[model samples]
Target chain A: MIEFTIWDILRNLLLAARWTVVLSLVSFLGGGIVGALLLFLRIGGNRLSTAFTKYYVEFFQGTPLLMQLFLAFFGLGLFGINVPAWLAAGIALILWTAAFLTEIWRGSVESVVRGQWEASASLGMGYVQQMRYVILPQALTVAIPPTVGFSVQVVKGTALTSIIGFVELSKAGTVVTNATFQPFTVYGLVALIYFALCWPLSKSSQILERKLNVAHRNH
Target chain B: MSLIEITDVRKSFGQTEVLKGIDLDVKPGEVIAVIGKSGSGKSTLLRCINGLETIDGGSISVAGAQLLPDEAHLKALRLKVGMIFQQFNLFPHLTAGGNVILSQTVVKKTPKREAEAMARKMLERVGLAEKFDAYPDELSGGQQQRVAIARALAMQPIALLCDEVTSALDPELVAEVLAVVRELAAEGMTLLMVTHEMKFARDVCSRVVFMHQGRVHEIGRPEEVFARPKTPELRQFLGVQ
Candidate 1:
């Protein structure tokens, strides 16, 4: 049996943690783009586009992400288009994150009063101009806090990609635990790393919410 | 000449008819005040003049532009006719100056510097020159309403439609907003106002229109309408019965 040092286990897990961070960043940023597109379509697109966006959000949100990851990894192979773990996991996580973000932001966008639109229109502004100048600016302020909060969920969601055979934090923990027979230390450390990533996001969300409340009350 | 002409204009929301076979002629430089009880279609009539509400069964011509769903002519007519609302819907995200300058620079294609200068002048005209950078939420209701008037004036429209512009103000605040309307009246601006302020209407308006059950029940010079109020509805509306 090889003598495995605790330091060696931590070191290897740390290397794998880098992939976790990268995966989360990719998922979150890609999701943001897709989410904004979905929002625009849902708000202003034709009936078909609006319906498609509605179903897309519902499909992702209603299903468990683990099953979706399995389907992405396994289902693509069924069609002879073999997707590597990274591509499969990336695509799955991005879709999941986008679904939640679009719904989250729709609430924010709708929070702007109807009077804003009417007032802008009365100024001879067209629909697009009214949204750009008046509606979006107001909606964006209400959106910031929830968006940051949702990103933490994206980070945590990255952990589920391990089921697709992608080597993120959880996978690295399992591999290290199997080698050293010390599941407690390895899994515990993995949880702590997750806490480290998520804590700041939660704190920032709280701060933003408080700030918005104060700003609202001042008005 | 009539700057705004409405012939048998009608509007309804769902099953309830708000304006039924109404007619009004607004000449240039005429200060016409529409006064009535709540739900009397005063605001709807004013909104229709600006194309904010489409009439179901009649025709409207504002500055030779027929009111239709067409975008280009409607935009042209909007430039010709400015509107102020009861709620003082000044953009809260913008400064008083920004709110005034936005439509000029964006819709009217005025240069930024020119628009800013015009905004400053208009703000001064409304007694809000010092509050140019103040957000709508930061100002009192009277000041906010004044800012809304400044925003409408910056367009240099041929006529202004005010839909109960002072209704949202406190009693003390109402006088200040009405004062701005009085100034506009004195300057010979064509004004269509829907107001609950009887005294202000009598003082400033060249003509008074009394709406009832979605029809123009009585309309004449301010003194005649306020004093005689021929119909029972108008008498009751005036609390004269």
Candidate 2:
């Protein structure tokens, strides 16, 4: 067997970590935009569009992420689109993240009191104006903690992209393990890296939730 | 022509009828107080006038334009009629002046400087000139309601609707809100109010409408309505028997 030191494993894993971070950031931002569009469709009171968004969310959320990645990777091939692993992984992650974020944000928007709508409406504000000036501002505050909390899931979700041969941190671990035959050290360090990334996000989300709750209660 | 005309207006929530065959006319510079026990549909009637609730039967016209459920008509009706709620409903994220400035800038498309000037003037009229920078949660309930009144007044509506505007305040704070309404009445702002304060109704209202079981059970001058209630329902609502 070739000599593989701790430094070798660490260096390769760190390089792979960059792709994981990059994938997580891109999907999260893309998901936010798509999720907002889906939200408007669902709440815009158009029957057919609303139904489309409803099933769209259900399809992505109801199925497993691994299945989604597999479908995105190979399913596009069947259509002769022949997308690369990076594009497939990006597309799957964004769609999946958007599905979850839509429900999360819809709950936040609904949590605003009915009186806010009535009050804004009575002021001659149209639906869009009410949302822009009154409703969304209030909903945004309530949305932050849960939105941040969801990012932790998005970060971990980048791991599943490995099966598609994206060669991120988790996939790099498997390749390294095959070479060194030390699953314990290699996989153990992989989990450690993921932990290091997600722990602060989870902590910050909890902190934000508590802080916002206290601020609201103070009012 | 009257500023507002309601004829045989009816509204129902699911199977429960909240308003049944109501008819009333509000003229310019009239301050009409609508009073009754809980569930009498007084608040619902006030809401319907501003197109907040869609009427199941009959018609409501404000400023000679019929109140329709469509966005254009409702928007037009709301432009001519302003409403204040029991909860005040000031945008919590905005300052008092910001609350008053929003609709003027947005709905009326007034220039920003003009909207700010209008906001300042209205806030001062409501005795909240000093509170222009305060957020809803930072103010007392009474102060918030005054800002709501300012917000409505900034629209320059032909009439105002008060849905128990003082109901949410502490007893001490109630006087401040009623004072603003009193000033509005004194200035001849056509007003329709749903209230439980009998004294304020008798003192400040041009007419008192006693609603019972979703109909106007009694309607007349405040003195006539309060002193000589013709219906037993009104009498019992007045706690006279």
Candidate 3:
């Protein structure tokens, strides 16, 4: 029976917070690139491409993220494939982030008026050119608020990684709670760390959304 | 040979035939205005000419390039025929100059500096010299339409198709956009406009074609078409004797 000092618990969770940040960045960036490609395929004219992307999005979005972690961790091991908790969690989070990101981006892109497509075409831009030069730029303005907002979800999502035995903030909380038998104090610290990371992003996203709406309205 | 030609062109989406049988021709530098009621296929006719809307039957040739359903040829044909829309449709992310310069740099492959200079001049010509750095959302409807016109002119297409280019403008703003079209026509830019501005059609267009039910109801010099229309449909459509 060891009594864990608040300072000791805080230090351990602070160290674990680094992994949470790293995982969030890795998952967000990986998901962004893959999501962009998925969005391109979704809009491009191939029926099969669209169908495949649709299923990929729906499969990830429809399931609980915790189950995805379980499947990624245990399901792979059952199939004669061994993956560390870190790798399994990262993969599942990346897939989950990509699904939601693609949908967010697709809605933003589609929100561009049909007339914009016609205008770009009339300027002699092919499909790719139109998207790159005309449509995406406008859509990006509309896309940013939601995208920044979604990053908070990515940060919060890192908590589920601990369920797969990845030693992140939540798991550190569990460890400290077991050793110190102070669930209230340990969990409060964990919640505080999350609030610290998420609150700024949430506020910034709100500010950005307001500014964009004002700019759009003034225009 | 006509600079552009459409013979018995037909188009349909799902079960609705948008362009039943359209025939049109424009000599080099000719300005033809196609005017009709909503759903009268005025815009569809312009889109068909630029290969934006593929015709189900017949043919369209622009600047000697024949338009077909094949995507490759459609892109090629679109290059020779520029268009402007009722909505300015400028890219919201890009500045006014960026919108005009993109086609020049990417499709035309002009050097960056030259493309930028040309874009500036086009914007200036459209009375938006100071607004070149502004985004579409930052400008007024008239300004956006002017940028669109400048964007189209930057390509130097053989013909410019304007589909209700001023229809979305405040009545007061319409003249500013029409003034640019008038200026372009004066500079020998072959133009085809689908507009509801009866006065602009009578004043600026060399020929006025009245479309009814996806077919050309009448085509003649502006004076004849507007003053002494031959068909009852034309007179009724025009609401003039």
Candidate 4:
């Protein structure tokens, strides 16, 4: 059997970590755009569209991310669409992240008082104009903290993509363990790398919450 | 011709009917005060005229434009009638000037420079010219309400609806808001106020309406209503104060 040095394992995991970071960003940003669209449909749509968006959010939120990745990975093959592992993982994570982001944002929008709606509407502003000028600006400030906080969940969620054979940080740890026979050191280092990626996001969420709330302290 | 015409208007919230069939006409430049105890639906009537609340039956027409549930018509009607709330309801994120400038630019499509100029003038009219750059949270309740007035006035609406505009202010701050409303009445601006300030209403309003159990219990000149008080409900209402 060939011997593996600590540096060899570390280098491989680091290379895999890059994919984790990339997948996290892609899913987060893609989810944000999709979530915003869903928010408009839920907020501004007729009863039919509102109900459609509600169930869409609920279905994704209710399901396991691992199962979704599996469905996107193997389920598409049944329909003659053989998506690559990376594409399947990205699609699954984005859909899952969007479900959470939509609910978080909806809560932020609803927290704006009913008086704000009446006050803006009475100014001769239409619904779209009211949302653009009055509601969204205020809601956005409230949305930032939870949105950033949710990004941590998105980062951690990237680990599940490893199950789909995309070979991110967690999957790389397993591959390194099989060759090096050092499960404890490999998994511990993998956990540390995740903490490094996620800690700043968690801290920044608190910082943003404090900073944004300052504008409304007296309000 | 009357500036606002309400014919057998009705409104309900769930199983509870808030406005039992009511009718009233407000002529140009007339200042009418609607007063009653809580749950009397005085505020509901003002909200209906502004299209903030939908009427269950009958009709309301402002400046010959019917206040309909359709978005285009509601927007058209709102352009003609401005409303002030009891909560002041200034956009907390916007400055006093920004609050006043928003509708002017968005709804009226006034150029930015012209909207700013008009915002300043409206703020000056409400005695808040110095507070143009101040945010709503930074202003006192009285100042905030004045900014709300400025915001409404900048829209150049034909009539103003005040839903207990001074109710949220501290007792000492009430006079400043009333002073602004009093000035508006003096300048021939049509005003429909659901108010509790009896003396100010008597002095400034052209007519007084007493609402009870979601119906107009009595209506007449403030002097006639306060002095004669035809209904016992009105008599009892005026008696408590």
Clashes of each: 0, 0, 0, 0
What is the per-residue lDDT of model 4 for residues A1-219, given as tens digits with 9 covering 90 to 100? 988887888899999999999999999999999999999899988999899889999899888899999999999999999899999999999989888999999999999999999999999999889999999999999999999999999999999988879999999999999989999989989999999999999999999999999999864
lDDT of 3 by residue, B46-102 (tens): 888887777799998997899976757877887888989887778776789988998
Tens-place lDDT digits, model 1, residues A1-219: 998887898899889999999999999999999999999999989999999999999999999999999999999999999899999999999989999999988998898887777778778988788888988888887889999999889889888988888999999999999999999999998999899989999899999988876665432
Least well predicted 10-residue stretch by lDDT in candidate 3 chain A: A210-219
lDDT of each: 0.90, 0.93, 0.89, 0.93
TM-score, every prediction: 0.97, 0.96, 0.95, 0.98
On DockQ, the stronger of 2 and 3 is 2
Q: Which is superior by DockQ, 1 or 3?
A: 3
After superposing candidate 1 on the true structure, give the runs of residues whose Cα lies further than 4 Å from its correct spot.
A216-219
Clashing pairs in 3: none
Error of 4 at B237 (Å): 1.4
Q: Is candidate 2 or candidate 3 better by lDDT?
A: 2
DockQ of predicted candidate 3 = 0.64
lDDT of 2 at A129: 97
C-alpha displacement of A194 in model 2, angstroms?
A: 1.1
Sort by DockQ, top down from the best: 4, 2, 3, 1
Best by lDDT: 4
DockQ of each: 0.60, 0.71, 0.64, 0.83
Candidate 2 lands at a TM-score of 0.96
Question: Which CAPRI category fits model 3?
Answer: medium
Model 4: CA > 4 A from native: none
